[model samples]
Target: MAFVSSERIIPISDGNGLEGGGAFLPITPTPNDVWNGWAHSGAWIIQNGFNGGGKDNVTSAPSQAAQNSVTVSDPVTQHTAADPVDVYTGAFLYDGPGLKVGNGEAPMALDYRPHYSTNWRLQNTAKIGYGWTHSYDIYATERHASDVDIHTASVAEIAPYWVTAQYLLDTVTKIPTAKEVALRVIAARWATRQVLKAKVTVALGERRIEFHRLSDGSYMSPSRFRVALEKSPEGVFTASFKHGNSIEFGGPNAHASKIVDQYGNECTFAYADDGLASVTDAYNRTLTFGYTLGALSSVTDSTGRSVTYSRGSTFDMVDADGGVLSFEMDTYGHQEILSVRDGLDRVVVVNLYDVFHRVWAQQPLGDALKPTYFGYAPGLAHETDAWENPSWTKFDSRGRRVQTVDMLGNVATWV
Candidate 1:
């Protein structure tokens, strides 16, 4: 008889000394001959033709990468669909050649790769004159645009500015849906940047009005100034001017009322069902307003001064004194260009806008010729010729003109 083992098989011969002796042959197991069994602990037992039976532990073990699919609480609830919780796959650590010791601890590598992602990268290296420096760049995966290192500080030195910038970009600027963009545009149009807990000084002509914005979004302008504004809970606003003259504005559906002077001379207002009707001034003079086909047709002031408006592709307003102000509108019907003309139809003032729809220049009837240039930084207005002398107006982060520097380097600062 011949016996077969896992490593080798031996053949037996009977009476091999004879010339034609018969020998026993060895047989090997096939795939169908293998046995599959299970252990008491529920582990699978696999038997191979060459190696015999063994337990398969590789498939039974849990995978570390598979833990990424585990459920977890979302940190950012706003814009839930675009949450970045599951965006990262894994993290890795690396060290540089430089080594240093600190606090009696083991020597550690001086440089390290803290964190990185497919959408983010860190550059930390030592420079000759600048010393060691690091920068983190964040890329937009959807747009495939260039990366922006938002960690840089602004002139105001506000900390963590990148957080707000990223939030705005994710929520507003980078929104991919058209419906979301439309809704955001509408909301922004109606939103008011009300001054809350701020002190502001406004220069009008030759006077300066200092005002303080209250915490409740209300403003207080003291009696020292010529103008003041007060708001009511019902959305009504009352504007008081010098000499006890005041104007009160009602809600959107209500008309405005006014008091001319200290003697309590009242001016009552009336409005038509669709629009404005007429205003009777303190002197019992009525200023009438007329509309034709939902458009303003004429406006007559209390002093009997009237202006007639005609609307076509452009809007033209001709005053009773023969002065004309023609307005050119953009595609959205916004007044883009204004041309002021005298009775003779000669241009008096022409204001122009750049391609970006910003106020580029203002041309007034002048003897020397060129128009006045205007510049802007964010929300601050920079006009070099607005002051008494050639000067530059500087505004703080709150968009308040905080300082003014003249040509002679004389600076007038406001708190």
Candidate 2:
């Protein structure tokens, strides 16, 4: 059978917390100076790129698409000469740090981040076309960031004009009471539906679609669309593309989850648990899995960082080869081998942070086994060998040593 272990983290705040922000203390694993390196480790992962393998380079996930890149077209607009319909459409993608699990045949991959760029163009009948590209990159622990952009002009006229307005309804849990939502510039209604409750009706061309939220009184946001419908002579009914109208449902959390890397600001594990999707923090930074596990095991956000929990927790052991294994974390917060020839052999313990984006781990050998220096890089980037020394080996991407020599001449860095 599969042996499982899990982690949970929550916040603790006092009313007297600082303004513009509230202090959050970790609530688990009896947090003490022993685990003080958590945040420093998180920064390491953001900077050096987490996975042992260096495949997650800056351009690993480079994505490029021109209007004609996918399906080339220069269709004229449906506007008259007076209005002179000029359609303008642009494609943009904001790719963040993503994890690529190994198939064993390949090396384990983590924090593979590429620059996120938005490419857009605006055009009208009077002009040819113009477009611009903006790109952003985070360096050194998902904190340090820089961006470079290139603006270009095009000889081809921009795509014809088209307008799309999306109306979003959030889960009832999100809206405290009577919250007013505005659907600005309602163009020709394409489709609508109540995602959480059938009582709500969304109409497209001329029919209505039923939407519902979870039984727990959660309201389905506009993004949690089920189907598009319209009000008919008799009642709300479903509609097809008979009049060039179409309906499509947006995935859950499609809109609410986004990480903004604004200057002088840092955030991690920002997401919505609406059964939709998860979002990373501003720097796409995270710690090791071990660290995350530790945090979750105690259900306390010791770093007082932000995190989003999507669902309940379950424990599962995985082997180095990426296969399911039989190992467990004992009540005392140590890993035990369930199927080993020797009963309950000591194993590695993992703690996670930044919503499991970063991980930290340690062997259950007790404080005596603690390393002189806690290695940097989100969690334990080097599981090949147990961290054993307080050596100053971490260097910046530019090969500059990051370990600061403290007052006692002790050079160290903590996350």
Off by over 4 Å in 1: 1-253, 258-262, 301-305, 363-371, 378-391, 407-410
Error of 1 at 254 (Å): 3.3
Instruction: Estimate the lDDT of model 1.
Output: 0.37
RMSD of each: 34.9, 25.3
Highest-lDDT candidate: 1
**Clashes in predicted model 2:** 68
lDDT by residue for model 2 (1-415), tens = 0111322222211111211211112223232212233322211101132222132222222123211112112222111110110101111112222233322111111132221111212311101111111111111011110111122111110110122222232222355444433232122222222111223333221122333332333323233233333323433232223223232222221111122222323232322222212223333433222113312111111232321211122233222233332222223222211111112444333322122222223333323254222222311112212343222222333223333322122434422
TM-scores for candidates 1 onward, in order: 0.39, 0.19
Please write out the lDDT profile of model 1 over residues 1-415, one tens digit for every residue: 1222322322211111211112212233336432211100011123242245342222323335323332223222111001111111111111111111122111111111112111111221111001111110101011111222234322222222333445446676453588767765554432222212233433221123445554455555643355776657875656567656665655422334433456666755576753546655444556566677755466665455665667666556575666665444444433333444545656655544443344434556632245544433332333333232233444444344455444454445565
Superposed Cα deviation of residue 159, candidate 2 (Å):
11
